[model samples]
Target: MTGFPGVRPRRLRALPALRDMVAETSVEARRLILPVFVGEGFTEPRPIASMPGVVQHTLDSLKRTAAEAAGAGLAGVMVFGLPETKDATGSQALAEDGVLTTALREVRAEVGDDCLVMSDVCLDEFTDHGHCGVLTESGVVDNDATLELYGEMAVLHAEAGAHVVGPSGMMDGQVGVIRSALDRAGHHDTVILAYAAKYASAFYGPFREAVNSSLQGDRRTYQQDNRNLRDALREIRLDVEEGADIIMVKPALAYLDVIAAARAICDVPIAAYNISGEYAMVEAAAANGWIDRDGAIDETLTSIRRAGADSILTYWALEYARRGATR
Candidate 1:
C-alpha cells in the first residue's frame, strides 16, 4: 500500500505510555472538591433515592465522611444543609445553631486545616418557599433584601470556620456584599467562591431532592438563562470586580462553553460544578450496564478540566480520589 502523505495522528495512541505522556488534561485529587449533604435531625445517614450512593448525613456521619475525604487528599468539601424547619425568612440560614453553620463547624473541626471547608451561602435550603432569597409581599424575590441576608449568612459561615463560602443564589452584587460582611467581621481571610454564572437548568432536579427543597416554582427570574453566552461573561466580570476570589460556572457538562469562555477573560480561579443531574445520568447508565462507570467518570471530569476549570465540584470526587490513589 502507498504511504499517506499527511502525518499520522494515531501513533501517539498506539502505546499506553505515549498516550499518557501526550495527555493534555488531568484531574488531580487535590484540586477536586466534593459536595456533601448534612441534614438536621437525621439520626443516621439517609440515602438520596435519585442519587445512588449519596446520603444526607448526620453530624457524626458528616465528620467521618470529611475525614475520609481529607485522607484521600481531596481539596475541599462543599456542604449543603437540610434544616428541620422552614419559614418565609429562612431564619435558620443565619442562626448560629442553624443546620448549615453547625455542620460547617463540625466539618471544620473534624478536618481542621487539612481540607478547605466550604458552605453554600443560599437560603433555598432553609426557606419554606425554597426560593434562593427572601420574598416580597407579592411573592416576588426581593433582590436587595436578599443581599442583606446573604451578608448576614456569610458572616455566620465565616464565624463557623468555613474556609470558603460559596454564594450560589445568583443574587445581584452578592459577592461584594459577602466580601464586605466577611471583612467587617474580621474574616478577611475567608475566601468567597462566587457562583458567577448559574443557569436555571433542568439538571438541578436531583439537587432539589437532595436538599429537600421546598421550591414552589422555578427560579428563572434569578438564575441566568441557559441560552445566553455573552451574559455569562458579564456575570463573571461583575463578580471579579466585586472581589470574588474564584468564579464558578454551574452544571459543568452543559455549560462547558461558558467555563471555557470564562477562562479566557477571568483572572481569578475558575470552578465548574459537575451538578447532580450529570452525576445521576452516569450512575443510571452504569447501573444499566450501558457504560463503563469508572471510564465515564474520568472522561467527564477530564472534559471539564480540558474546558478550562481550575477546580471541579463533583459528587464523584471522593470515589475518584480513592480509586486514583489505589492506582
Candidate 2:
C-alpha cells in the first residue's frame, strides 16, 4: 500500500485553509436551484406539515421569493403548482392562466434573465387521480396518451417564459413528444431538463403531501423501480437521444452512484433532486439534536455535488445560497 510519503496527507487535513484549498468539489450558489410551490388563490404562504420549513406560496409571495432567489445568486427556481382543481385530463395544466403558467410569467418578469426559471411539466399535481398521466378504461396509465399531454404542458411552460421545462412523468417517449411540441410552437430556445432517472422511491412521501396528491394507487408501473440501475441509464440515453438539453436524477442522496454513472455517460448537464422526504428526515433528526444541522446540510449538498451533479435542486437552495454556503 502506498502512503503520502514525505508529503503526508494528514498534514493537508490539519487546517481549514488547507482543507478548503484541497477540496475536490465546489458547491456554489450558481449550482443550486430552489424548488418552489405556488398554489392558486392564497392570501399568504401556507406551510406544508410533511415538509417542515417548506411552504406553498401565494403569487405575491412567490414573486417576492423569486426576486430574493435571484438576489441570493441561485442558479434557478423550479416551480411546482398546487392547482385549485383537478380533473382526469389535468386541463388546468394547459390553461393559459393556470397557477403554474401565471407563476412562470411572473417569476420571469421578476428575475428578468437574472436566473433560470424552470417549471414542472407533469400532470401529477393537476390530475384528479394523482397519477402522472391519464388512465385508460382499465385504469392503466396510458403512456402514449400521456405523452401528448406532456407535450402540451411543455409547450405551455415554454410559452409562459420558462427557461427550462422539466418533464418528470417518466412516461416513455415523453421527451420526444415535448421536443416536437416545443419546436412546432417556435420555442426553439427553451431548454428541456428531462427527469430521466426518477425512481419510485419511499423518499417521495413528503412530496405527495406537499403537492396535495390524491393518488389512489402506486406509480410503480411507470416510475423506475429501485432495483433497476441499468434501466435508469437506458432511460437517460433515450431521453438524450430524444432531445433533452439536460437530465436529472430524483431524490439524489440515495442515488449518488446513479448520478455518478449518469455523469460518466451523459454529455449534457446532470441535475439531481434533493427531494422533500430527504429534507424532512434531516430536519426531523436535527430537531432531535441528532446532528449538527448546518454541518449536515453542507455535507449533504457537498456529497451530491461530488457525486457528479452539475446542478442540484434542493429545498435548502435558498437558505444555503443566502448564507454564502460557507462550511
Candidate 3:
C-alpha cells in the first residue's frame, strides 16, 4: 500500500478530552427558554397526551414552576395561556384579566426581574376555530384585521409586565404594528421576537393539543410554505425591516437551514423553537428504550445551537438544567 501523507483528522477524535476541547457547540441551561402552558381552573398540572411529562399548569402551580425556573438560572419562561372562553375574534386575548394576562402578572410578580418573561402574542389559544387570526366576512383569515389585534395584544402583554412579546401569528406587517403599539403605549423597551420563518408544519400537532386547539383546517395559506426557502428569507427581511428585536425559526430541528439562512442575514439575536413534536418523539423513543434520553436531548440541543441559534425554546429545559447541575 502506498503511504498516505497529509491528513490526520482522527488524531483529535482519539482522545475524549481532546474531543471536548475541540467541541464547536455547547448547550447550556442559561441559553434555554422554557415554554410553559398555564391553564384556567386547574388545581393540578394536567399532562398533555401528545407530549409526555409536559403539562398544562394551573396559576398556582405555574407560579411555583416559574420560581423554580428562576432558581435554576434559566434564561426565561415563555408563557402560553389556555383560556376558559373562546371567541371568533379572540377578544379575551386583550382583556386585562384574561388568562394569559393574569398568568404574566403573577409570573412577573413571583420571579421579579430575576428572569425574563415572554408571552406568546398570538390568538390561536383564545380563538374558537383555533386559527391565529380573525375571520373575514367570507370566513377566511383577514391579514390586516389580524395585525390590528396583534398590535393590541402586544400592548396588553407589555402592560402585563412581559419583558418580551413573541408574535407567532405569521401575519404580514405584524412586527410593525406591534412595535408601533408598544411605542405609543410608552412600552418602547418591550422587546419584539418575531417568528420570522415559521412554516406551515405538521410538527405543530402536539402544540395544538397543548393549547387545546380546535383548528378546523390547515394554516398553509398564511404560514410559510415548507418548500420555499426564499420566502422564508423574504419574511425574515420584512420582520427585520419592521423592527424585530429578535427573529426566530419555528420547529428548529427540521428548519436548521432556515435558521442558518436567517442567522446569516439578520443582525439581531436568532432564536429557534424546538417544538412539542420534537420533544414528544425523543421522549417516546427513550421510553421505549430506543435511545438514551439525556444523550439524545443534549445532542439535539447542541445541533440546534450549532446551526446558529443564539437561544432555544425547549420543553426539556428543566430536565436539562437538573441534569447539568449533577454533571
RMSD per prediction, one decimal?
1.4, 1.8, 1.6
lDDT comparing candidate 1 with the true structure: 0.94
- Note the residue pairs that clash in candidate 3: none
Task: Summarize candidate 2's per-residue lDDT along 1-327 as a digit string, tens digits.
Answer: 567475667888999999989989988999999999998998889999988899999999999998999998999999999999999989899999999999999999999899999999999999999999999999999999999989988988888899999999999999999999999999988999999999999999988988889898899999998888999999999999999999999979999999999999999999999999889999999999999998899999999999999999999999999787454
Candidate lDDT scores, in order, read 0.94, 0.93, 0.93
Error at 223, model 1, angstroms: 0.1
Clashing residue pair totals per candidate (backbone < 3 A):
0, 0, 0
| Alpha carbon deviation, residue 290, candidate 3 (Å) | 1.2
Order of quality (lDDT)? 1, 2, 3
Ranking of predictions according to TM-score: 1, 2, 3
* Candidate 3 whole-model C-alpha lDDT, 0 to 1: 0.93
| TM-score of candidate 1 against the unseen true structure | 0.98
Per-residue lDDT tens digits of candidate 3, residues 1-327? 356966788999998899999988888888999999999887889999989989999999999989999999899999999999999999889899999999999999999888899999999999999999999888799999999999999999898899999999899999999999999999989999999999998888899889999798889888999899999999999999999999999989999999888888888999999999899899999999999998999989998999999999999998888889997
TM-score of 2: 0.97
Error of 3 at 279 (Å): 0.8
Q: Report residue 19 deviation for candidate 1 (angstroms).
A: 1.0
Between 1 and 2, whose TM-score is larger? Answer: 1
Q: Candidate 3 versus the native: TM-score? A: 0.97
On lDDT, who's better, 2 or 3? 2
By TM-score, the best candidate is 1
